[model samples]
Structure formats: structure tokens, C-alpha cells
Target: MKLKNILIVVNDIELAKKFYHDLFGLEVLLDSDGNVIMTEGLVLQDEKIWCEFVNKDIVHKNNSIELYFEEKDIEAFVEKLEKLYPKVEYVNHLMTYSWGQKVVRFYDLDGNLIEVRTPL
Candidate 1:
């Protein structure tokens, strides 16, 4: 079976919304009740990722996921992110990992790790 949308649990929905919006330029396809739907083809499938925010602490703590973006202008992408959300600097800072991928790792407001990388 193919994987559909992935759920990212966060403590603060509004903050997470702003973070992802600034980082990926994602559109809010659906926003009703307490749920928000983000569409950007984050995964290969024709699926829309969902980020559900709850008042409780994250069910899965210290968890991270890496999303490899095929960016033609890496520098510009990084600059745009930095300008919008300075707090994400820790989550999106540039570094070379042992796997030889240049990545920027940082956490959402609720502590979910997010990495944007360019594999070498």
C-alpha cells in the first residue's frame, strides 16, 4: 500500500501553521474546526499532509523527519525562511552530516525536528 498524508502532531497549531507556511510556501487547502490541511506534494503520492495541533504535549517526543526538496536556488530558499521565522534558525541551520548531505535541522514550536537537505 502507498503511504498517504503524514500527520505531524504539535502543541500549538497556529504557530506551526506559520512555521510551515513560511518555510515551504504551502497553501492552506483546508482550515476548519481545529484541523488544518496543507497541500504541497510533500510526499511523492498525490496526498496532502495534515498538521493537527492539540493542547496536550506531543504524543511522540523528540521525533524528526527529513524532507528533501529539489530546490533550484538553495540560497534563496534559505534566505526566505530566515527572514520570515528567525526562531527556526536552530531547526533550519546549515550543516554537513556524516551521510554527506548538507542539511539544516531545527524543531517546531512543539519540538518536532524538521530537516531540509541537499544530498550530495
Candidate 2:
């Protein structure tokens, strides 16, 4: 089997929805009283990632998940991300490594690291 949807615990549901929508342009697949679902491609064809915000004794912490967004213009994406999430930092300048690819990295909401890569 392949990996599927991932859940993120967020204290602010509205902010999370806005961030994800603005950053990645993910459309809302389902929205209820307390749950918010968003997806990119066909549910079974691609991954059905969902972000649910509940009012429980939940520990709002960052998981070991690194979300990556491939961008043709990494600089423009970075600019938009920075404006939305002020805590975003450039992990390093875009550089071609021995692996033969160029990449840049940054942090997203909840301090989860994200990488934007482009093949050279």
C-alpha cells in the first residue's frame, strides 16, 4: 500500500485553512462544524490530505513531516510564504548539490520544515 492522507493538529482552524489555501491553493473537499478537508487531485488517484481542527486536550506540536512544493519560480513562492508566515526562514540559498539538483528550504506553520526544489 502507499502512504495516504496526513493530519495536522492546529489550534487555529481558520488560520490553518487560510494558510494552506493561500500557500498551496488546495481546495476544500469537505467542511463541517469542526472538520476541514482539503485535497489536490482525485481522492484515490492522489493523496487525500485532510486537516481537522477539534476542541480537545490536543497538544499543538509539530510532527516529523516535511511538506515540499515544487515551484518553477522558487523566489516568488518564497516571497508569498514569507508574507503569510512571518517566521519562515531561508534554510539556505538555492544551490546545486552533488545530487545534481537545486533546492531551497524553509519553515511553515507549526514550525514544520518545507523544501522547494527544482532540477538544474
Top-scoring candidate (TM-score): 1
Q: Please name the candidate that would achieve the greatest lDDT relative to the true structure.
A: 2
What is each predicted model's overall lDDT from 0 to 1? 0.58, 0.60
- Report the C-alpha lDDT of model 2 over 28-94, residue by residue, as the tens digit: 7876654576785312111122222233343333445666667777667767776777676666756
User: Against the true structure, what is every candidate's RMSD?
Assistant: 5.9, 6.0
Residue runs of model 1 more than 4 Å from their true location after superposition: 41-61, 64-70, 89-92, 96-101
- Using all chains and alpha carbons, the TM-scores for the candidates as numbered come to 0.65, 0.64
lDDT of 1 by residue, 1-120 (tens): 977566565555676677777777777777655466777633221112232223333343355464445455566767886777666537446766688667666665655666667745
Cand. 2 TM to true fold: 0.64
What is candidate 1's CA lDDT for residue 6? 62
